[model samples]
Target: MIITVAHQKGGTGKSTIATNLAVELKTSLLDLDKQHSSIIFNYKRAHAGLEPLDCYSIAESQCRFDGQRPVPEAKLDEFLDLFKGDPKTDLVIDVGGFDSPLNRKALFFGDYLLTPCAPSGTEIYGLQMFEEILQEAEDIAGIHLLTHVLINNADKRSQKRIAEMQAYVKGKPEHFELCQSVIGQRISFKTAYETGQSVVELHEGARTAKLARAYLHSADEMTALCAEIRHALGKGV
Candidate 1:
């Protein structure tokens, strides 16, 4: 399965969520957002050292994507050629935004597109606009919505934020679903990125350590949800 984490908006934690999920799964991972590299997470996993585990093991490729816009049909054909050539691998592309040509290319590749949003209403409205664009593209292209919107950077302790997230999700079920886990604002995540380490690998005694554990829990739940979604969509093997 190719799950592309994308949104038309920035700072929504798309790379963070997608990168961590790939590490958690230990399968072949692909970072599609070229301009903003996410090799930091992959570097962390490598520094953490390899285990005797079979999962999203990424291939030898540049973390930066250099595909042309609209993913020219030939590009899609070439990708499909390579994609189908390796049926055992699962792919995850971290697109900068939902409106990018990379995302349009992903749709043609029969991949699932997921977008993350914050608690802000403007961001929420941006997501709606993003969905509108996607739907418009979908009218001409054949694609599937594995799962649409995922709430990121949420503060569960805030009754107001929780209510806002819930309300936004409820209002956009046709194009979104609320993730069960909430990722609180944690500085550890940003700090770990500099050293290319999972927040779990950083100083486990500080506030960052606490955030790392929380992130792990969220990733676990998300991984399971992804599996269930595949089954529900009849895309599982």
Candidate 2:
């Protein structure tokens, strides 16, 4: 399955979700974001003498854009020609938080799309705009884009905000499905990122018992989300 992790606004935990999925699933990661955050994280992991992730860089140079907009048909074909040629490989693409022709083209090739958004008014507005873009891509591609909107970095104490976000997503079932699994704003995630280790990779001695438990919980949440995503794509858990 080809999965694309994308959002138009930054700081929505796009890299966080992408890296976690890649590490947990042991899939190849295609870093299309200009920031190259995934690549850097993998490097950190490798430097730490840890097992490295299978990764590739699909730099912006490989894409052809007409002005600022990508010609969807050409871009879609380009991606399909390159990535779809390998039928057995599960690929994950991490796109930067900027709306571009390349990003739109990537969306068309995704068998499953995961968009992470924080619980905020601006982030919700960004999600709405992203849905419209996806709709436009669907029109251009003549196919329904399978998409899931993930609520990430949610505050554990803000039940009201989480409830509101859930309600908003429930009202827009046609645009994107809301993921039942959520990632909370926890310090363990930051610690794992800095060390180039996923929550699943953290040893007991590496963190306090409370933090280790938090990481374990986050890892379980991520695993459940991955299973849900695969099942949605008609793949076995």
Best by TM-score: 2
Identify the candidate with maximal lDDT.
2
Q: Where is model 1 more than 4 Å wrong at Cα? A: 43-76, 80-87, 144-146, 199-237
Candidate 1, residues 1-237, lDDT tens digits: the string is 566677777778888777655555454555555444465455544565633122221232223322212233345556544554254556666766537655566655644566777777888778778778668666767554534666667665676976786687778776676665555566656765655554444544245756656556444445565664455345572
Alpha carbon lDDT of each predicted model: 0.58, 0.77
lDDT of 2 by residue, 146-194 (tens): 5788989999689988888888888888877899988888777777777
lDDT of 2: 0.77
Steric clashes per prediction: 9, 1
**All candidates: CA RMSD (Å):** 5.8, 5.1
Q: How many clashing residue pairs are found in candidate 1?
A: 9
Give the 10-residue window scoring lowest on summed lDDT in candidate 1. 52-61
